[model samples]
Target: MNLESPKVNVTKSPQEVFNFLEDIKNFKSLMPENISKFEVLDDDKFLFALKGMPEIVLKKKEVIPPNKIVLGAAGGKLDFSLIGNIVETADGNSEVQLEFAGDFNPMMAMMIKGPITKFIETLATNMPKAI
Candidate 1:
């Protein structure tokens, strides 16, 4: 099944939005209790634990300045990727989009997608406040 990605609007500039989301440490604050063992690998990669269900190790895959981020999780029935992007709006607002894609059983998809979407929305909305 195709996963639905959510877009969130934030009252922040593109540069500001980019810098904030690029840091792995920020992810810890956005997760619900299921996640544990969040770690930053060097300056580019991140390793973390997925909470509940079929727990797995998640790694940051790609980082593009002021625009895109990609994360992947593996080690279980679910092998998925989480992508996020931030763009500047004309009126000085920022638009952030979070997308999920993978090959997983329907049951696993149904269970994890919603919470991940919600987490992305919450992160995009509150990220500015953090900076």
Candidate 2:
């Protein structure tokens, strides 16, 4: 399954936004209010648990400076990835979009689509203030 957010503009420059995201600790500001727990495991990983879901381990998989950040699940229970795209605007501001992709059986996809969509959408919308 694949989900994507509408591109949104942020007042910050791409480099500034990228810098904030490069530091895993800054992710808490972008999490949903329902998140029950969030912790940075190290420079490239973080663990979080939502109200009714199991803890998910996310590892920073790839980075293309000032442009992209790729995060994916670890520990093998689920296979999913979250990609953040940042583009510099003519005015030096930034436009950001988020893509969420998961490999799951049809039944599993049906069960989690709603919550997953809400999660990524929330992140994208919160980006303007997250940095």
Candidate 3:
């Protein structure tokens, strides 16, 4: 399954946004308010538990300077990647795009589609405020 969030324009520059996301420890600021627990395991890894979901560990997978950042589940049931693409605007601001891809069985896909879609959309929408 693949999900893409709407492009969002943020007041911060692309480098600023990319720098913020490059650090896994700053992810807590982007999480939903319902998150129950958050822990930073290292500079590149973190664990977080949502209100009703099992704790998930995420690790930074790749970085493309001020252009993109990729993250994946460290050791979890779900095999997924979350990618952030940043484009610097002429006005010195930034446009960000969020993409999520995961492998799942049909039943699991049906069960999670809605929540997962909403989660990604929420993340994209709130990212501007987070920076």
Residue range 17-115, candidate 1, lDDT tens digits = 777767767776665455656776656556665655334455678888778878777454567777777888899888887777787687877886777
Backbone clash pairs for candidate 1 read 34-51
Identify the leading candidate in terms of TM-score. Answer: 2
Q: Kindly report which residue stretches of model 3 are placed more than 4 angstroms away from their true locations once superposed.
A: none
Question: Candidates ranked by lDDT, best first?
Answer: 2, 3, 1
Ranked candidates (TM-score, high to low): 2, 3, 1
Q: Candidate 2 at 95: error in angstroms?
A: 0.6
Report the candidate with higher lDDT, 1 versus 3. Answer: 3
Give per-candidate clash totals.
Answer: 1, 0, 0
Residues 5-64, model 3: lDDT tens digits: 899999999999999999888788888888899999998999988899889888999999
By summed lDDT, which 10 consecutive residues of candidate 1 come out lowest? 49-58
Better of 2 and 3 by lDDT: 2
Give each model's whole-structure lDDT: 0.68, 0.90, 0.90
Q: Model 2 misses residue 108 by how many Å?
A: 0.7
